[model samples]
Target: MSDDELGSHYTDVPGQRVVAAALRAAYAWSVRDVHRNAAMLEIARMTGVVMEAHGPGRGPVTPLELVGVLRASLGSLLAGVRGRPAELADVVLLDHEGRLTENAYDLVCEHVVPLKDVVGSRPWLPSWTTMHSDQIRQQVFTAMIASTKQDEYVASRRFLVEHPAGDEQELVELKDRAGGVRLAKGGYRDVPEDQLYRAPNGKGWWWPCAECRWPMAVASSGKVRCRYRPHSAVFDLVPGDRPVLRRRDGARRSSPPAGRPAEGAKCVDAGVWRFVVVPGASELRIAAAAEHAGAKVLLWPFLDRFDLLVEAGDEKFSVDVKECLSLSSLIERLRRRRPSARILLPRSCEWQLETLQDALPELAVLTETKFLGQVRSAMRKAR
Candidate 1:
């Protein structure tokens, strides 16, 4: 059966709504004023709904119980119900500190947050509802899509990818270069405090992720890692007058220690970095690698119709990179909009290729490693 058909069986279930409420509650709990948040109220309402449907006779489900179930496993909460895919169902949505888990971020980006066009000025949504990073990302991209011509769109997006973070002067330079592009209007902001590491000398700094070169998250415990965990460049801050990062032992990959003074640094808003810079890093890397392998690559060819058009010898490959963290969400998107080019899973997302192929057998898909190998072989054949 198709993914859409499989998803249909669970549409009647309250799993999606329950999950959304749980995530919002988690976010609310992370902030200082939990009681004042609408998410707390929403979670209480959803708790009652869940109890009525799944665990009757269990009176007064506390917020803690709801959070515990979510932290324990989504499957535990939705047991005996064929709602979410096993991959997503088994995910732990909250960490011990009540922060949204990485998978929860993926879920928010993939499904929960509707694009600006779809949201369309709904009066029912609370005015106090702060936009999630993913929601903001969707809105920014939606605006870019509506405002710019195709070539301008590609240039604007490429600018964000190449310069996710810089100082005020750099931002001014970007705007000056951008001319009338909407991205020039409001694409950046002061880096968030949570993304800065405080040193023993009391100075704060931000470190760029080795992979994406965007500011990494600095945990209170001195652990430093990229918000997008796939980057996998973890480190610990060694406090000193001039603080430095110590590459944590057992890291899957290695890179040189990196940090920058955060005093005057501004970064592309969280949404843009998450949605654009993260994937764009991979897209740029793959394009560079293919060109290195003697392939002529055109990025966002035909005025942003697709990601890359690579030509090696007489062989041509048109590719659209897929770098999402959620497999089910990716599959659903693919079902909705058929891709015009072969889907290329970047190195970080290579694990998803088999599952994607299985889900959409008719679609053309390949991994970064496989695609690069093909490019090299084609180059050799021409020689």
Candidate 2:
């Protein structure tokens, strides 16, 4: 859905009202129209912003300004949430400050993301990724942070997260990634058609998430992505080929496909495999490297609050490994829960190491290369 239309689901509830107002205010800045409504005007003033009449006026607010307004708006809204059970799924509009609160942040992660039923919902943007659900949320949050950054007048504008250079190339990379272990233990297979939801009109079927088996939407570009985004892998139909589901009689269960998911298959939640599995894989790599380097290493120390705890020579270190697509959101989350463990950004987020160090100068940040080097150095000292 377009940013301007974000608040359509908002209502008169205290928290929702602020979200609606924030969305509208963000939209107003995008369109360069002064939001004359009291709520919007109050938020703008609180954000120290004054809308000026200029151009055709459909541009995004500067990222810094957008961040400021979102912070102020959420603070005001969350104040009214005191003594109330705030469901994370209920939050629509978000900013850094709102995400810093455990309740609000958890709400965003648990429910607000992987925007429901966005399949075939809107024209695809150049920056959109169908690979992982977390990537999708990161892109959405980036767009929200860049509300005034787009030129509404431009038909084909690149978003802040747009990786135009990687578009076709990445889709090519996705070809081999379409199939995965159904629930990471039920065997590996591609998402089958019968398991997918049929479109209401029965023309075409919505794609199922590679991880969750829930229906995924298609974008204008004909790319199939999970509404939940972090599911990550993008998919495309082989064209003219349809999935065929063999029927079953009463009280009869169909035999599972060799490696594919079937309707109503028992398995773990999709999100666990998608978000945790990959990082877990990285953790193994780190653990192997640490052990190979001859240091004593522990996994899931203290019941998984941290990924790895290592004792090398006279030095000891705790590490939390993260492979988040949106460094901005990850940074915001880290600010709230200051981990005693140093953060390790895996190869996937290697590009973000320098930026993260700058953002959190007080925190120790390491890339795979640097971290492995430290492990080796510690091993040598132990020897």
Tell me each candidate's TM-score.
Answer: 0.81, 0.39
Each candidate's lDDT (Cα)?
0.69, 0.43
lDDT of 2 at 308: 84
What local lDDT does model 1 show for residue 32? 26
Total residue pair clashes for candidate 1: 0
Residue range 1-383, candidate 2, lDDT tens digits: 44434323222233332333334334333223322354344335323322211113321244445445444434433443422224322333433323222222112332222112222121221111112234433333332324332222111111111111112334234423432201112222233232243433443443434334444434433445444444445554332334322212222343312122233332222333334444555676677788888888876664455778888887887899876655655675577568768899876678889888898899888987788888889778877
User: What lDDT score is found at residue 282 in candidate 1?
Assistant: 93
Identify the runs in model 1 with alpha carbons over 4 angstroms from their true place.
1-13, 33-60, 80-82, 113-138, 142-149, 174-185, 250-255
Encode model 1's per-residue lDDT on 246-353: one tens digit a residue.
888755556545678887898876556777788889999999999999899887876566899999999999999988887876887788768999999998889998
Query: How good is model 2 by TM-score?
Result: 0.39
